[model samples]
Target: MKMTRIFVAALAALGLSGIAWASTAGQREAEHFHWHNAGPFGTFDREAVQRGLQIYQEVCSSCHSLDLIHFRNLGEAGGPFESAEFPNANDNAIVMQIAAGYMIEDGPDDAGDMFERPGVPSDAFPSPFANPQQARGSNGGALPPDLSLIIKARHHGQDYVHSLLLGFNEEVPADVHVAPGKHYNPYFPGGVIAMAPPLFEGSVTYADGTEATMEQMSEDIVTFLTWASDPHMEARKQMGVMVLLYLFIFAILVYIAYRQIWAKVKH
Candidate 1:
């Protein structure tokens, strides 16, 4: 009898927890957006990726860190800044120029002291905050996640990121209570986010003269991040296609040989 009562109480508690979770966990589904790199034959749009890089430098870099990326990656084949003339990423002048813009920290000389130096193609991107504690302290106790693999990290990653960027709602729903320093985004779980709306119109003047609309910026940044997450996607897809074609031809040849060998021996 005691075991039965305990079971019943536990079930009731679970039911109440489920109900509470259902109430607060209503998040809008991410809207789908057509990507240039969606299909097997798809390739990333270089222009959009370049623009996205600009957006990251101008805005996102202030909070988020792309810890996994290096400046040399920009000059690699199929990268946003790839140039036919520069076969080696380290030797690419444009990449070198971009790297030079950032200051990097280097280690101890004979004097045994750390020092700052100009960034190089081989250097990993610098974090805006020195540590996690500093990052959290600046952003109301929320650490801005590294954007390096963000596209691959989230569910429905591409769409979710794009929608979340555009999903911030100024008019809060009556039932939802937004806490101090938090913003309402329907796409975010629990419908609340610590990072406020980051993109705005005219956030950055595009060098290529593209209008910096909120939607455009969101799409561009997502594209850049997608590339960052999978820099070798195009090469991988190409290899897959070649392998499939080779297998198909090999299978056909084997079938032909089998038919020839069994011509006189009928089962």
Candidate 2:
């Protein structure tokens, strides 16, 4: 059929595109990682997400901006700071306090000039620098990518991120050459990364008294990034399960009706 041919052609095109993408993405195999949020029924570990947020705040926020996230997002379900007491992050005392710590550029005043004001929960996470030029200039001419959707944007997603974070060290293969100011990381696409090793055994002191091992930080941050990328993941999965249950019940009813109708007819 014409429809069948069209579907086949579309699939062929997709396959070709995937091949092209794979060829250019990287030569190194992405290391597999197990996460708590990996499957259909999976849910986020709230405490781990909170720790990840803490790590991001203390370390990653200096170089990378979480531009797409707002203070209010931290109060939503599946988020690190989500809670029954503070269901609305916009009005939550903690979120309000965190937001107020930053100074944001705002609207024209009576004199029609731009002014700066303390941030609110409604404001976006502030960028570390004024612009890309500033960001690049400060970081050896390489602009740090935003962390907003980083877990989703990369080829291997969170696994790639986890590997890259733990992959850095002083040792490099004899044949590989790393330029000054850049670090060698085998997990990175080109085996060279702009950012240095950001994680260490004691880089962050967790308020929950959890030991801040390198692996723990990487895993926690990845978990937070995953939640940031898809805040509605839990809701979506729940809805999918409900839909499947409804379909199963409906099919059983339809089958019973079909059997009754057939019984009334002659063979």
Candidate 3:
């Protein structure tokens, strides 16, 4: 009984410590947004994803890099560039054209010098800067992080992304000090962000003619980022459904067999 009491006291202390730690983490609660890619049966919107891609290419791509994504991923099944004519994403003409637009660094030649060539469908998205120093140098000494897995990296994931993008330009509190190059965004931790207001009312012209409101852009970009973070999420959810159905049916069959076997027995 004494040991149990001690254990309980220890747990209470640990819980209090956890609360203190959470308070010190500096994370502000993000505003919630309805995501089509959320929940069990949720699927990505092709047009929204495509529009998000356009936004990334036109604006975010100037500083942020999506190092993990390849051009061909757009044309893959369930992706934005899905094409009935070209099932094989690697061979998709649109993907090839997009990749060809960028010049990638190739291997050293016979003279031991690197060469540049047009990128291919399989090539990863190229970084905006050559190195970390260059990236930071160009951006007022703030390194723009790669957006490849940002959706997974951030807490509250999708909601956080949407809020941060749309929460800019708010009135700064008297106590809060925003740096010269920084901007005020309540959704960001500590209520400040190095990135300026990226999304505007008329930022990029949507290809599908969707109104380019701040909220719409924010939602679209978050969808694309979520998909980029976990391209196989939909497939995994589908497989999970199949497995559950199989197990449920198997359990029913087993229960029926048990009843039949026990019926012939005495209790």
Which candidate's TM-score is highest?
1
Model 2: which residue pairs collide? none
Q: What is the C-alpha RMSD of each candidate to the true structure, in Å?
A: 11.4, 5.1, 7.9
Best prediction by lDDT: 1
lDDT of 3 by residue, 97-163 (tens): 9899999998899999999999898999999999999999998999999999999788778988898
**Cα error of candidate 2 at position 238, Å:** 0.9
Write the residue-wise lDDT of candidate 2 on 83-113 in tens digits.
7897777877878887898899988999999
- Model 2 spans with C-alpha error above 4 angstroms: 1-26
Error of 2 at 165 (Å): 0.2
Better of 1 and 3 by lDDT: 1
State the weakest 10-residue window (summed lDDT) of model 3: 15-24
Q: What lDDT score goes with residue 118 in model 1?
A: 97
Q: Candidate 1: deviation at residue 104, Å?
A: 0.6
Per-residue lDDT of 48 in model 3: 84
Error of 1 at 103 (Å): 0.7
What order do candidates take by TM-score, descending?
1, 3, 2
